[model samples]
Target chain A: MKSAFTRNRPLATAVTALVGLPLLLAGCGASSGSAGSENVTEISVMDYYNNEPDKSFIGDALNSCAAEAGVTLKRETVPGKSLISKVLQQSSSKTLPDVLMLDNPDLQQIAATGALAPLSDFKVSTEDFAPGVLSAGTYKDKVYGLAPTVNTIALFYNKDILAKAGVTPPATWDELEAAAAKLTEGDQYGLAFNANPTYEGTWQFLPLMWSNGGDEKNINTPETTQALQLWTDLVKDGSVSSSALNWTQADVNDQFLAGKAAMMVNGPWQIPALSKQPSLQYGVVKIPVREAGQTAVAPLGGEVWTVPQTGNKARQAKAAEIVSCLNSDKNQMSMAKARNTIPSKTSLAETFAKENPKLATFTELVKTARARTGQLGDGWPAQATKIYTAIQAALTGSASPGDALKQAQGQ
Target chain B: MSLAADLSPSKAQSRQHGPAVDQAPLVPRRRNRHRKERLFQWLFLVPAVVYMALFFGYPVVKNVIMSFQDYTTATFFTGEAPWVGVQNYVTVLSSSLFSTSLLNTALFTIGSILGQFVIGLALAIFFQRKFPLNGILRSLLLLPWLLPLIVSSAVWRWILDKDSGALNRFLGDLNIIETGVPWLTSTSLALIAVVGVNIWIGIPFNLTILYGGLQEIPDELYEAGSLDGATGWKAFRYITWPMLKPVVSVVLVLGVVYTLKVLDIILGLTNGGPANSTQTIATQSYALSFQEFKFGEGAALGNVLVIISLVFAVLYLRASRRAVDE
Candidate 1:
């Protein structure tokens, strides 16, 4: 009996390995559709719209576009931060999805890698889009992606608190400081903004920096030093919370909603959530410029849809069709209305603003907003890192504004 | 044990002396049977060996190869990572942030281990006493370690917030101090606060392991020591310390290895921020690879960290071998 059992065990194990290894190896092959499948049935798509309102809104648009293009959509979503990492991993494995969504600023970086198919090759029209938004999705003068709607940071104030404190929305640097100080009372800070050690921090600082004539290429100049000093003075005077060094844009909105901050610098994405708060009355305006008459050149915020190079020509062309369909004026207007952002097409901006009165301020702000990658292209990441590092050093008192800028700029 | 004995004819010869014919026919059959048994036993180990080879060995080999190449984001799409021959190592070592990250790594590991060990040992000894609801209370102490590290970090972020945090609010309510301490926002205080939270997370792990060791030391030793006038502090000095040496070495060595690679806690809390005061080698390597897309330089830094850990692991194995021999 024992001999029978022992003999059967080895034979059983050998049989299992014989069947399993081949199956596992077969499962590990390339993931995307074949290059020349004649019947082009379904196209896989991926994006970072993992959060609510966006998750469903983007899903609805993608489904509608896939129907228009005569194909089915296979969808994948990841958190906003992990999208690039996922793309790189997929690209290396040759398993990239047909359609990919990239945050606008990240488009140049990925496009420079030659992993994306230029939309011009597919004859997708890139006309009539906002100049800055189009530039963000372009690399080497070839359009790689296009955003349906775009956004930028602006000043959001608690209307009730500002009314009770008798302070109008500040329009320039000096007025901002005075109003912030006068409103500071009890547990609330007068103003709040993100200075966290990330690209978001660099994004928030851009309006202040660009409005004062500071450029990313020349961060150590007097123009930049004055911008850094403005933030430093606020931290020093205690009008802004010292905790801004650790706060993300979401945390700033949290403080604003909690009555712990009278005003915050944020974007229009917070409008839906702000309106959800029944008792919370808020108003929006352009980010205060360094001086009156200066343009408030906020950093542009949005995501762009692109066709990844999956080596499937038919599928690639179809993916570009879906991309264009997603960016159509009709789809752009509807998505903007649903998501509370401004349409990327300049012609649609007037109608979008009139229809969504609450977001009129943002519609005007998006026209003059600057693309982070416009000057540096793929090189913007390293510069953005230095900008935030300088901001943190100055805010924490580890270095003075000029010294911090010099050290961070390595000049 | 039987397999080893069966393989050695010398061991069998010393056990029996018999006539040639009595052993001949049986010897050949017995040898065939033993060989079959041996092959069967090895079949059980094959799956685990293959798993470790695929998951662990492949990544280590890939990382070593990548460290020698000029790997970047472009390499992912083009598959054109050229051999650079130590250029990545030079770049990583030459950077000014290298020394700062190295020092921070050492400070963080030492601070977390020391605080965790001392507090954990004290808790273990206290819990050894016979008390009401002792088992339930001791088990509940593991809640912090049981929670995911990210959850603990998020909660701690709120608790340590300078203005509206629970810690500062409590302090203010008690009139302990007028100004709230900038726990996470200040460069000087951020490292200390990070270490404090890490210690809190680590204490439960150390407590459970050390408490198991304490349980294994028979009570008769303490009873005999008390009779010999070795009571209380002397009992702990002469008996507990000597008996607990093996567990102590294990806890400390494992603590060092684990703490040296801690990333999520620091990333969640401050993201190595407030002027990079809390940046460690592990976090710096992550920033290089994931954030900056300099995969080659990141792999070089990771290999440096692995070399440090390997030295400790080798010393630990040698010490443990000697302990077993004694």
Candidate 2:
């Protein structure tokens, strides 16, 4: 946990991989003679990753890895949640793909249930991966997944809206409140925030909690209560709409594009969607602090590839190989560039900026991203929903935030 | 169940006539119904029964078990669920919200059924007159019912919007009232608005069914009444009412069952909101199960709703049988 706050020195290994990505990819092609009887085995991977251009960018890297390893790669696209459900369903029927992409697969409980195959068993080295990335996919100190990209949350704002309001993006809690209030007018809201009354409603809340030095599952504490208080204050002051309760991030995005909202706290996944609205000019900013003098610390969330235990050892081995190759620097770089995703390796952040300069601003913000506060466990799922929904009720004037926080903490 | 069956020829009769009817000795007894046939019967039923057992039955049973145990959908997805017995249900009951939600659901059901039945019966009677444009108007009447629930709910939500709602704007333009009422946003008014919308959607169904029932009543009886100097309201009450009784009873009971179980309408309408005042049992049950993953508590809620519907169904059947006998 502490290693996360510390650098942990991944710079040297990442730089090496970045320089070698192209050369290693080149060596993948035109193998013959002494290459032995091993032929390139092509496997398809399906994920909700990026649009066509970014998909092709990542596709190119996957192809390069296949060539280098005498293996071929094919890809399929699906929404992340749908893809994960498909994989889980396939486990019962033994109809799994060679490789899969999942977000917050939370394989620890799955691994504990003997679903995921341990990575150590496959002889894969984990030294190059980020601490949290590997740890999130591990169970009882055994790796179950290899994440190609690291996705984090950040504050997204309309540059035109801010400029017209004669305000810069707020750096601190008080400043955020003042700026948001100033930006508010009839039919134009200051902040488009998540008001979804669900456990997962913690997206905006978590960052606020962290900035206040609070953790999840302990929401009744002073720091957590302060975080909840921030939202309650906004709602009560009419800076935020009470009707935003139980809304998805897409709902917030819709409001922003319609020119009804000035600023909203969303995520990296929303960048492409925002970019698609050519008429709307916006930029990504680090989340504003809700604490006395702290910087915003938005939590990171992304997908990981994991192999599961099954009757067919041959298929399982092949799947493991596919996971390993897909995690290569070439594919990671392509994904980073194409999808605006931060690869688990810090080096790809530079590649992403070089490939797509527009995303450089967001890539820079990745340095200070924090993981969500709470153990990724089974107990947290429904409890989180109850807590968030109650928070919504509190914010919407049905209950007080203090009472809501108390209920959540009790749960 | 026994009354509803389409009875096949009796096996006992065939057995009794077997000695005299059978010609082939080598074929033996009951050639058409062999042990293999019995095995095949089990086999045919297996796939459908197994499918239900796994997907529906198991989940229902599991849900009941889970309501007793503190379970979450996310935790269930990860596959290691620790049991905390009856805590979730006790908590749900003790929360002070469930009782009010249950009352809301009952009120909604009663209000919706009464409005839909009365209005629908009126439409059915009007359409029975065979007017010049009856066919066109009958088809047009189904517009609300034809639209999907969620889509219509969203449209209604906009129309009920406090600021930009079309209904409010039109009412203001017409000066129907001094000011607009917060149709959906108001805690006290949301439930009434939802029930009103639901009744509107339900009218076509009642009209169609009652219209069909009106057809089955002979014109001869009405003609005889007219010849005997029986006039409009009196003749209609004595002659038309008796025939329509069966159909009205069915509609009333079915409406009770359906309206009681209404969730999507409530979910799409106000999402049981403004506060707990508009909340319903069906919505709470779904929210408890899928959204909260408290399957057990959800199941308990569901079971209560199911029992409510089942009681109405049984009552309808009993009344129908008594009506037939009388």
Candidate 3:
């Protein structure tokens, strides 16, 4: 019995090795089977429009585009946050979809991986697109993606509350501070914005930071410090809720809708949800600048469509056609109108703004909007992290604005 | 024991056969029988061994290998992760945030375990009494565990909201303070609040296990102790405490392991915010890999966490062995 027990131990280990080897081989085998084929009748697409309105709108556009290109569409939609990881996983497995939709900021990071095939390779035209949109899609002077429409953050305020408080939408820093303070009352803060520790927080802070002459390249500068100080002062003086530190953009919208916040810094995407409540009389304006003449340079917010390097030339050509079709002037206008975003083409902007008057502020902001990844390329995430860290530290009163910037910069 | 019983009968039959046959031939026949028995034993263990290797062993090995390389987003496409020796480990360990994450991890784990175990034990003991709806109450206590972690975190987020949360509203109704408490927003209070929520989620697991242990301790000992003038605290000290040690060790060790790598609760609650006061090693590792795309440093930090868990596992093994010996 003792001999049998001892002998069985090694046999168990051998069996484990035997089973694991086959499983590994099987994984490799399955991935290899997905390699390029000659005849391509179906074009696979992946995106992050998993929610309503945008989902149906984007899905309809994709289906129409696929029909235009004379191919069947196999589209997969994931949650917003999981899109990048899913793309990376699919890239490594050599199973990346023919067309992949990436958030504008993430396009550069993924393109740097050599996983995306540049649109230039297929001679896709990007003429008449907004400069900011083009810059967002360009990495290393090569355009890898194109967005149909884009959006930017703006100050959204409740008309009823602001009228009762006798305050106009603030256009400059001092007016903003004064209006916020005067509007503060029981159970209602004057302003709400996201300052959580994530990329969303960084995106929200960018308008204030950039409008004040701060640059992502060096956030420790005095301009950035001043921007940080404004956020700190807003929280310190009780004009903004201390809970803004934990609220997401969605939560900020909820606070605005529930009348807990009189004003919010958000984007046009909230228009659908805001319109659902016909009782809500809201208006949008540019996020305020430090001085009146300075432009409120908010970061451009949107997703870009790109063809991944799936090693199938025929499918990639078809995918590029579909992507180009999705960005056509007609589709862009309709998508922007339906989705409440500004069309990516400069020519379409005036018409879009005229049609959707509520998005005029956003369309105006998009003209001077900056792409988060445009400056840093693939190195943007680290700097974005530092910005939000400094925001958190300064707002939480753990460090002064200047000191927080310096500390985060050092990190 | 069952294996021994089967082997003994076979050995006896082999001995009976050996006398009727030639001794030289019987030796080979017995050896053949022994080989068949060993093969059968190995076959019984194959499924479990294969499952472990495929699921547990492969990922661990892959992670360890990844920690030594300069893995990044580019590596996923190009499939080239150049060797960087221990550079990833050095960078992660030397970062200022690493120390903070480590300390927060220690505090989060310790606070969560202590609160869960103590409260869980108390509840388990209380339920040991005869009562109407005892079973129903015990099962109801498991609601937190049954609910998804993200759902619970979201509910807790609203409940602990500074301005409009249920908790602050209650506190305000009682006139405890003028302002709403920032349960999840303040740097000073975030970690504590996270630990409190974790403890609530963890109680059901500890209670179920400890309650099972409590049941296994025969009532005869308690009755005899009572007859000897031991009751209440004395009866528990003498009769219940010693009997519960093994189960207590198991629960504590398991609790520490689970709590050490907790990610979803913290991510949903705070996302390691308010100056990263609530950032733990698990969350930091996740941020490094997924958020920043620094897979090498993430893998290194993950390995560090695995080592910490392994230390506890070894200690538990030693303690359990010693308990068995006694």
Candidate 4:
């Protein structure tokens, strides 16, 4: 050989480079593995449920049920800050957990994504589940998710702060704004809220939009603009701090518990957390209306259990079993007790109320509470992003509610 | 160090531009000798090449093809693509948000590059010579760069929080400021805050690279220049500046490419928010893909991102050559 060294040098280098590159890459890359259905007897249920340290909670009860049912359960509990993003990411990979818990309106979005597996395998209907709870998961005439636990918005007031300030809970936005101004003082913000578009901006503003006599689907209407304008006025009048947009729902609950703010628009989920706080002297009521013609609105919020249609019969069957367990009356009651949610079991409202007194007003509000305009389980993300972002933008002076909604809807 | 090489390549591809088929054989024993050499070369390269072709190259081509088809994951692996050619591209190009992302990316890149270069160069020159705790200081300068951008941006998010944040906390404590500024909540201030974070992150890399270049300049040159009536700023403008040109070009080109593709920082910091003020193309692409449930549109966004970065690379390379010519 005229020289093996000279002849193979370039070849060896190239080969080494080729082999080394793959080895290096293999050692350090995110693998998009095929989601195998083999041995998938168990279903993973992820919830936007916040974990409590208590010995008994909704998450723990669910785990106990899974243990009782002899099925594997992957329980994921996430904070409000990362919940939506985590759900979205999991959905994109077709690795959606078999069960999910979150606001009902989001289930509508997931259904629209074709991510929430249809409940066809289980063949459950709206009649099989609680009214309004099942509506968020029905798309194209197919039901997708089942709500095991549900909670909707309610106006929360610090009884101690308001009582001390000699103010009554306001029934209308104008009175609420007035109460806020009266209560606000040195280093004490009057009202606490979360104005995040995907979070409070959607949940809190939905009621405002409804109070102003605007429909969720028609979010860019003049009434919606006026509703947003009212909120903007609150910000300008110094009744509500502009910083609320960045506050998380959990964060607002903390501020309320700390007695930092006089009143806040919150939901039933805060009941268990707040009830234990020694400084928490709060009462729940209907979300305030802005006009006499309008009624207070509480945006529909809840969770759903689902089965993804990945075309694997065995996998689908296992997922369905998980969903069935989730929808069972026993599980629903368990979830309600642990999650501190409004029982989706219509029959248990009285029981839930007697056990948790803070939930009583929210229950009353639910009678008139506005279900999100995603009856077909569609159009909320597109609409809410427009409605809520506009409301926030107007409040922050990024746009007039009129212009913000107009811009958001691309009108 | 954490950022060094943590990406899993189990499916990563190794790419190569092979010699043409008409290449002359090695002298005489080039045939059998070549066979053995080729065997060894192929043996080593086979794994990486196969990995790349399977994972990266194949997926890229597949994704591009998928972009043209009206398809989802369900449709793609089913052995056929319903080719509705150019529909995805049409949807993206027609969308107004695409244009916004492009404009935002441009603004973000240009603004950050200027800040990184000027400030990085300053720090680099400042740290050029030996000093007390020189090694310690150089290592400490790498802290922001060394930490994951996720951790950095998360920390920055706390600092920029409108309430109970470090920035507002410090400012209020000094009594120099009366009210807490909404560093991120404001539409006008959101982008600026994210850019400020990006600049903070980008400075260390530039400083490290430029400092490395600064060290290469012999100390005698500066001493000789000082003797030749070149002192202080004058010495740097003459001997130091001309010599550092190659390294500066490298930093600019490298920095531009990397910053233009930045996704995590912008996402973690603002999410293109306060109404899309901080929205970059990558985050927008991510939003389109996951949030909006439009994978084709998302892929189109990635394509646009790739095209934009390619253009930046070409332009920077041209500028680098021009500098060399000058």
Ranking by DockQ: 1, 3, 4, 2
Output DockQ, candidate 4: 0.21
Place model 1 in a CAPRI quality band. Answer: medium
Model 1 reaches what TM-score against the true structure?
0.94
lDDT per residue (tens digit) for residues A1-411 in model 4: 434454456566666767677687676554534366566646576765564552246556666657655677777778855766676656554555666665566565655555556777566544644556656666676777777667788778888888888999988878888899998986567888777655456777778777777876666688888778877887787777666766668878877777677888787667767878866667877777876667666666766666654545555666666666666777776676666676666776777678867678766565555557454244555566666667666877877888888887783
| Local accuracy of candidate 1 as per-residue lDDT tens digits, B204-261 | 9999999998998999999999999999899889999888888888888888889999
Candidate 2 Cα outliers beyond 4 Å, as residue runs: A1-88, A128-132, A350-357, A373-376, B2-97, B143-150, B153-197, B220-242, B260-301, B319-326
Residue A287, model 3: lDDT of 90
- The TM-scores of all predictions, comma-separated, are 0.94, 0.78, 0.94, 0.83
Q: How accurate is candidate 3 locally (lDDT)?
A: 0.91
Who is ahead in DockQ, 3 or 4? 3
Per-residue alpha-carbon lDDT of candidate 1 for residues A1-411, written as tens digits (9 for 90 to 100): 644564476558856865776787679876554858867889999999998879999999999999999999999999988999999988888889999999998899889889999999999999999898988999999999999999998999889999999999999988888888877888888899999988988999999999999999979989889888988998899999999999999999999989999999999898877878989998888888888999888889999999999988999999999999999999999999999889999899888888888888888888877899999998888799899989999999989999999999982
Off by over 4 Å in 4: A1-103, A106-128, A257-259, A271-276, A310-321, A367-373, B1-30, B39-45, B54-56, B66-94, B98-100, B172-175, B315-326
Error of 1 at A74 (Å): 1.3
RMSD of 3: 4.1
TM-score of chain A of 4: 0.81
Candidate 3 wrong stretches, greater than 4 Å: A1-28, A31-38, B1-26, B39-45
- Report lDDT (Cα) of residue B22, candidate 2: 41
CAPRI class assigned to model 2 = incorrect
Q: DockQ, per-model, please?
A: 0.52, 0.11, 0.48, 0.21
Show where candidate 1 strays beyond 4 Å: A7-11, A14-19, A33-35, B1-45
